[model samples]
Target: MGLSKRRAHLRKAWFKKGCVSPKKGQTVAFPTVADNEFVRFEKKSFDRRVHTSNNVLTFKDTDGTDTTVSALRPRPNASNVVDEYSGCGDESLYPDLCTNKLMVQAKVQALFYSSFKEHRQDKPNCEGDLNFDAAYSIKWGLGWRELLKCTKCSCMCDYHNLYEEVENKKRSG
Candidate 1:
């Protein structure tokens, strides 16, 4: 069977099993509350309580306007892309500790390809001829490690080895 047909079959099965369903056409009705009551609940839920030590300050901009900053809301536990450096930048620094070695290697290979493309584009051609030195530099050792380290956080891990392990797993799997 083709991929699309298989997907459609799976979707139908999912709906039949109550795992998936279309949204109801009917509109949902919500209960209306008084402004005062809403304000009270909003204060309790979002701002907590106002105390001398824990009280949050509200201020207006330069143009004499009152403004209030909402308290930080709790986030749901969901998978998200985090960069290297544990926050942003090179993936080598903040390795995806959650992911298996195979996944990490795949990511590194993708990175290598992207970097190689950029390196090729940056070099000037020798009068319509390709720059052999620049090509060699990119193919042999583009200093990807040093570049990654400088841009990413300081983590004492061999990313090349990690990539190799992941690649091996990918091949086997």
Candidate 2:
């Protein structure tokens, strides 16, 4: 189903199951920032009612990629709202808003994890096998493979670069 419809259905089911009555000008539903499915969030506030994006500041780069400024990251203990996974944040406009922001981040994480689990390919287990050379780059495309290894782990991977292929194709044709 469409994300909007799914959100609506989930909202209805949630309300039917008994939530604190919403007040005027509160966000009823908002889309998760993923290319996947919807996620249900616990309704907390009954003080306001308005449909608005939780994000106040969002910017896209020339490549259409979302870019986050480094100065925006909150220092430790900057806010009362503490995310169990991501830790605390900078001072929020309000505590409720801070909590909601953490919840939204968690929701985004959950959605991404779900999508990854659904479509991700199983990687080779490199537990005892920390040795990774360019000898095992999977050849699926007519491109040069760049060897990459995880700094935190022994896992390694190849990234295909089509620049060399395009040049060769141009020369031949």
Candidate 3:
């Protein structure tokens, strides 16, 4: 299949930023995020030059308003995006999700779903942090160890490799 739905959405969003051909060793700001964020595209190496991966994306924070940028919710085709102040439901008391930490969490959650896929699958009826439950974790065969590993590499290779392995096993079986 072509890129998965989420992956395609990310690519479309990235491309909409007018990233036609990012020069080598050049830094470009992702238009989806605020102007301070910088993403450095990788240089094409020797043999596998066709496949270049951008591994360095940096966020530059300035002290003032606009400390955080809101992600585009209700993904273009998504029908279930809720109107919540904060996904963690702490906004009523905390009231400050614009902090750097929460910004990072939101970005990570948006870009990497492999780590949260099990939770999302288990709690399809719920939104935000409520999707993560002990019962769902147990039913999905995920625990602290698996969670740790997923968090470590879900944005990169671990999840893809595991998916491929499972696909291969299914095909062979």
Candidate 4:
């Protein structure tokens, strides 16, 4: 019928056959009542006990599936113990709780630089009739003017005047 009923029936049968003995604290043991049997009686003896405390037991059945049993009672004072363990007033332990701060920071920095370049590229044309031509002028080296000239007009102009003219054209346009 049910698991408890089946276990009780097995216990009664074992006890009646002198195959088990009852002990204190919900224990049952197989004890040797007589000798001269071929089975090596002492080696085959074993004990079975029922747990009365809050513990989890995992068992596997013959079909290879697992069964888990847990206590039904709730632990007393668990929240109070947890609160005491984590201090009543502490903020330093929480440190913002980001999972990957360095990776996020690097991604944000990369986004900022990418957006800055995009904004510079998207600015409207400003230089109106300046024949700003230079192959590799030292004055216009590695500046926004050089970049804009290389990108837009295909000619490099004076760095200072190119920056001012670009800004002025951006504002006007």
Number of the top-ranking candidate, with TM-score as the measure: 4
Query: Would you estimate the TM-scores of all the predictions?
Result: 0.16, 0.15, 0.16, 0.17
**Candidate 2, clashing residue pairs?**
24-49, 25-48, 25-49, 25-50, 26-48, 26-49, 26-50
lDDT of 3 by residue, 65-115 (tens): 332322221223323355343355654433323222212344335435764
Q: Any runs in candidate 3 off by more than 4 Å, and if so which?
A: 1-96, 102-112, 127-173
As for lDDT, the candidate ahead, 1 or 3, is: 1
Report how far off residue 102 is in candidate 3 (Å). 9.2
* Deviation in Å, model 3, residue 130 alpha carbon: 6.5
Off by over 4 Å in 1: 1-44, 47-102, 123-173
- Summing lDDT over every window of 10 consecutive residues in candidate 2, give the lowest-scoring window: 41-50
lDDT of every predicted structure (CA atoms): 0.37, 0.38, 0.34, 0.36
What is the lDDT for 145 in model 1?
26
Identify the runs in model 4 with alpha carbons over 4 angstroms from their true place. 1-64, 73-97, 104-108, 116-173
What local lDDT score does residue 15 receive in model 3, on the 0 to 100 scale? 43
Please give the range of 10 consecutive residues that has the lowest summed lDDT in model 4: 40-49
> Can you write out model 2's per-residue Cα lDDT over 32-92, one digit (the tens) per residue?
6755332222232111211226855443334556544222232233333334534335552
- Model 3, 108: alpha-carbon shift in Å? 0.9
**lDDT preference between candidates 3 and 4, better one:** 4
Q: After aligning candidate 2 to the native by TM-score, how far in Å is the CA of 53 from where it should be?
A: 77
